[model samples]
Target: MTNATAERPLHSVSVAGIVVREDGRVLVIQRADNGAWEPPGGILERNERPEEGVRREVAEETGVTVEVERLTGVYKNLTLGVIALVFRCRPVGGEERLSDESTDVRWLTPEEVEQSMKEVFSVRVADALDAAAPHVRSHDGERLIAAA
Candidate 1:
């Protein structure tokens, strides 16, 4: 492999958790650096499994423990070469608190998410909320494109 190719992989795998409380509120976080509200997630570690990564990311960002239920959707940011596996999760324990990665954490209703987030990020929550079938989608980081 070329040095440049070795330095960066073709794409990166990330995991996101769509956590919902019994009250039907969804978890959302405002990023510390960007201040954009979205689900809790991050890059999967080298040796971590995707499900474990999802759990860890949610706990780290929102300070809530979760039980991952099932795969909800898969999203790709085509512009950034990021593939994110989103899972449906149920809150198990822990009180909400802000981490270094998050500036704010809130439990929002479905209507609130639609009003608060951009379409691309909001779809992730919508897919989970539907809880019907796994959605596979691609985006240019802001707008979603029809799946290929």
Candidate 2:
């Protein structure tokens, strides 16, 4: 492989947990660096399984332990060049807490969430809810993202 290819972050498989509660509220977090409210997620650490990564990311970001139920959807973002997997999950323990990576965390209703998102989060949210054909989805969704 070329030096550039060797240096490239190896295509990694990461998982995100959509931990929504009974009240139709979805968990969201404001990242410390970007200040954007988004689902709690992170890249899978070396030798870690995707499901474990999902649980760990949720706990690390929100201080809430989550039980991953099932894989909801798999998506790729061409512009970002990352393969993302979303899962339906439920928090089993822990309380609301923020980590160094995040500045805030909260659960909001669908309508309430739309107004709060700084960018296109609805598509990701839809992938999380649309489980009928849950599988790998390509970055084609980017075509729908409004240009900045």
Candidate 3:
């Protein structure tokens, strides 16, 4: 491998699902670790596909089964070097329940999402809800930063 490519630090890849219901509510989880309200997701497995990771993460954290619709946004945590692939999904089955990763699970309206989640996370939901194009954004783990 080339020295430049081999020596660069590796970035962690995470997958998130914005599970929207027929009534336009979005599924969200209150994280047990930090008590932050965000969509259900986690680090992608080494060998897992992005869509599979989304379904697995959503199910694991929120106990909701989802069918991935499309990639809604690609976000990078500039400080953490985490690349998060956020997908827009539709709930197909399963019940809402809490897991070790989440203390609470609830479906919220779009307005509630904007009020509840941090800018970095809320923007992901907003982009998914917007029917334009998938967004590419960078954030400092919480707030969005200007594109470079």
Tens-digit lDDT string for candidate 2 (1-148): 8999889775656777888887768898998998887788988788888899999999999998999988877767666776888888888899999899999999977776777773345556666666576755565433443333
Lowest summed lDDT window (length 10), candidate 1: 1-10
Q: Give the residue spans of candidate 1 off by over 4 A.
A: 2-9
Question: Residue 41 of model 3: what lDDT?
Answer: 97
lDDT of 3 at 113: 98
Tens digits of per-residue lDDT for model 1, 81-135: 9999999999999989999999999999989999999998899999998949999
Clash count, candidate 2: 0
How many clashes does each candidate structure show, in the order listed? 0, 0, 0
Which residue pairs show backbone clashes in model 1?
none
Better of 1 and 3 by lDDT: 3
Ordering by TM-score: 3, 1, 2
TM-score of each: 0.93, 0.82, 0.95
* Of candidates 3 and 2, the better by TM-score: 3
Of the candidates numbered 1 and 2, which has the greater TM-score value?
1
